[model samples]
Target: MQVSRTATKEDFNHLRIDDIKQPISESRFDALLEKLQINNLSEDEKDFFQSIVEDRMVTEEEFSTLTYEQTKKIKQFTSRSDLEGNYIADSSIGFEKLSMAPLLSAQNISDDEEYNEAIFNTFKKLNLSQDDGISMLNELGGYINQEEKIIFEDSLTDEQYDSGIRYKTYIGLDMKELVSKRLEELNQGLLETSDEDVKSDYKNMIYVYREIETQYNNIQDKNRVENEAQLEQYTRNTKPNPLYNADVVELYNNITHEYEEKEKKEFDELMDKLDISNLNNREKELFRTILEDKEISNIEMDKLSYEEMKKINQFIFKKDEKGEIIDDTLIRTNSRINALLRTTELTDDETFNQVLFNTVKSMNDIYEINNFLNPILNLISEKFTAFDEVNSINFITEDMNKVLDELIKTFDEHYQETEYDEIKEHYLSVINKYQDLKEQYNKTTIDS
Candidate 1:
């Protein structure tokens, strides 16, 4: 009879670890070990293959016991299987490790017991299945690798650093804590004055600290909240006017109250100067009616009867060659002036008078009026730029506020004299500019 011989360790010496595949059943694993002559193999080689088979068995047993919810969570982390149809994690830690099982069981790259313990605690707190937690840890490893590259290679460009920080934030990793700890280490090293190379390293750490500080501030600003009271006030007051469906009225209302007392006094003085002696009977009656009121509010002016308005119009206009009233110029000029007066809170009487005088004098035609008004409109745009810069910092200087006040007054004075469509367009533009600046100021930026 022929004697049967079993394969020895030397017979399978050519085999490598890469030759092993997954979905390895107990019988298949034993067959593989026997074929490779496990009895004759060295201690380290046998332990390595045996550990792999044990890990595979544990993974299969744990997967079988998973609830629906746990299985669903695990599916989110990994959707594929190995060549032999065994489940595999989709992260950096390969299928052989199957999640973070290897990190928990074997030694880590850095032998820091505390760091490894912290990671294990965090894994438990996440409340994920063993496989899911392992996948998460593997994903986290990618971010840590990126951070290590940045620290070790000193390749922290703006984009790279931003991406790394964002990933860490998404993973709930505390980069701030890491930075603070590193800073502490550097500070401690600075106390020792003996080694020149150590001093140089400390100096480099200082530079790195500056970059980290800037990035930290930027992140803080991006997530920072604004004052709730200020935000509420801005929202309530910035609402668009229902009548005009625009913010012009709302914005004008906001600043015009500051000039009400001064404007009322000016209006009263101007009315006193008008001579009723040169007026017709009807005009005189209307003039007396206006003067009767101690203060004519804007609402009262808007509520005036058509008869009262016509009488005032007649008194202000002149007669032409056709014996018809020439009140077009008067009407247009006053409309412009009144619109401006309604919105402005000008304290300078002389400047206010000059603006009115120039406006009335230039009213030969619409073209002449526009020519006189365009420069003032351009000035409003410039003032908007200045206001925007100040507002961005969440505070306005007295000088800038005053400049804006004067500019608004000038613009309001001339706005109504131009064609209604043209004036409305310019008014909307100014309002839109103000709104845009206000929005920019309200937004929370990383640098705030």
Candidate 2:
């Protein structure tokens, strides 16, 4: 009697169609399962088996695990019928051959019915003639295009209803006409009505309609460009319908400019008061952009280098409850505070000490570094300064709180175990030095 060897890694690499199609004997099956380590099987290997059972090709999600040759063979095998039984012709091999029997077919029928009904109702609501409405619906359904309009040829094929494409075009046209007609009615009402409240309502409606007209024109332009690409011809030569009444659009724009003018005036006043003398030309541009936008998006901000962030930290302002700027808003940067919060990232002791020494020597006042340090120290009350008292400490300002919250949350995710005693010693020394510097600065100020 001949003995069969257990399947190895080599056997799995070039799996035969028979290996997949035929079931192995009980002992051989056990050996194959053990060698493959079913529990340890990669996602692709698991998907491969699942695809075989489902009689479908493996999805792109499993592409990373299987090779090109393996994927092709599996697709062919799963798409075919009965290697062990009778062979089916390639023409009718897959289950998808049944006419309009798939799940998407049902969805298409419902969509067509809903859109066709909507087209009829729009014509009725507008009190337009039903003749054009019938023609539009027929065009959308790909029944006929009597005028030979610019439409996708493939979309008008026997089966394709030009469903999504032609429907979009008709809807855009209907909405544009509807908004234009409404704007004209609103203008007539604005002129006839003496009631201030009613006139204001008319103006607001006019503004909204003008906005819709602008958006519709943008969509029309996009579609024209797309059609030009597909048709390989000049679609732009087609004359466009008249746009929204310019008089109403102009009236709305004037109303919008009043609010814009007020905002621009406030922004100019704020810029005039800001001191950007110390910042370099590039830094000045960055600072101006920041103040104008009044935002420092953490995701975009983190992409900046440490030096750039250090500069930004200096200019970060504090905002009050009503989002109004409070005086004395400039942040004083300290490298030690940065290192502590980003401890896992900034690992070198020499670099940390250099930053700490620089901060201590150049410190101008007691409140120096308060904007950055106070929020972090407040988080650990027992180990740090008196955060609540206004005498020496400046508590966490509103804007600083938002910035610190994001940083601390990020740090918590990447935190690691380190020598607690060493970190504690360094922190205590910095706190003592900061307090001593504050006392000396106060004494000097009183004497002067």
Candidate 3:
């Protein structure tokens, strides 16, 4: 793999969590990010930076290496999963850290200079720096209308200067930090500003702050989903097993079907003791984070693999009538016995690592310990709800009052009037349907 000039020398626009684990000739740029005091990222953030680096999410110097077809393949994965659902699961598991999607998504490293130039030119035309252009994505980051777009130098007052500084920081700063700072400013202004207009401005600022906060949350949701997907890929690459949950469950059932009650209980006691459903959410989260956790130099499944632990819990294998692997076709694996051993007790320590575990987890559909839907489901649900709210207008082009009306209508028809059991069941069904649709869509995702 010859490193092209652009891939070798391109500045780190922003390093993603995924990048740190990737493999690219951008150590200079990555080192520069740390040196510049640019992103005060957390441990998880550092993991994302390493992932993209190790994953080679850096720019491609030679367009010849990746054609239009390749670029399309990359973009085509955007809808493969739901992101918002990921954040909800994270929050449920006592994870208070900011989501990874917003920051990670911005670090997309397309090698096409024309694409960046075109995007930058459009932003320049819109009277903002190239940085500000991406930052002001109504959905990715929060936007403030400023009542009126005040031109620079329109006022040198403390309010305008502070707001302008915020505007600039809004474009360049980490989202979570940016929101925290703005809230601090709002609190400060409450004590300092006695004027009505100034007070109103502060009030409007709350709404602006929330929008960005929501977006940041949504971005995190996306990161959760993408992380799961990456884990799925890494898991597939690492694991040697061809079996999935259906196969495992079938084996479990068949083992019982043929064995007597006493023998069946032998494995049942172990499985029941190590109930697969009882694992903590964080333990499940480890599989996805394990993929991003680059601090560990190498990832193998067998040594400390979550799958190996579960697979060995039963410690029994079903045999065919002739004592051969049930599926002879899969026996063609590079190391047939080793592959089968992955789903049994014979897995070796040599294969223990994040990458290998991830592959096994993916094939097994090992979700984060929380039984909640995938993160991608959460993001899509939020957007869908927002869209529904926007669309359920009795009158088109109505303002905030119309939003209130829609909310009133929704609350009245669904939550407010129903009996406890009926409404609870209905709400659960709706949630289930939302999740089911998300799963179906994810499975059908077209890989370009």
Which is better, 2 or 3, measured by lDDT? 2
Against the unseen true structure, what C-alpha lDDT does each candidate score? 0.37, 0.37, 0.33
Residue pairs of candidate 1 with colliding backbone atoms = 100-134, 222-446, 340-412, 340-413
Instruction: Score every model by TM-score.
Output: 0.19, 0.22, 0.18
Tell me the number of clashing residue pairs for each predicted model: 4, 0, 50
- Give the lowest summed-lDDT range of ten residues in model 1: 1-10
Q: Which tens-of-lDDT digit does each residue in 331-434 have in candidate 2?
A: 32234333322322222232332343344324434355553355444553333334322222332223322333444543443333335767555444544554
Error of 2 at 387 (Å): 4.6
After best superposition, candidate 1 residue 46: deviation in angstroms? Answer: 11
TM-score of 2: 0.22
lDDT of 3: 0.33
RMSD for each of the candidates: 33.8, 26.0, 29.6
Shift in Å, residue 437, candidate 2: 25
Clashes of 3: 50
* lDDT of the structure predicted as candidate 2: 0.37
- Per-residue error for 266 in candidate 1, Å, reads 75
Off by over 4 Å in 3: 1-173, 229-448
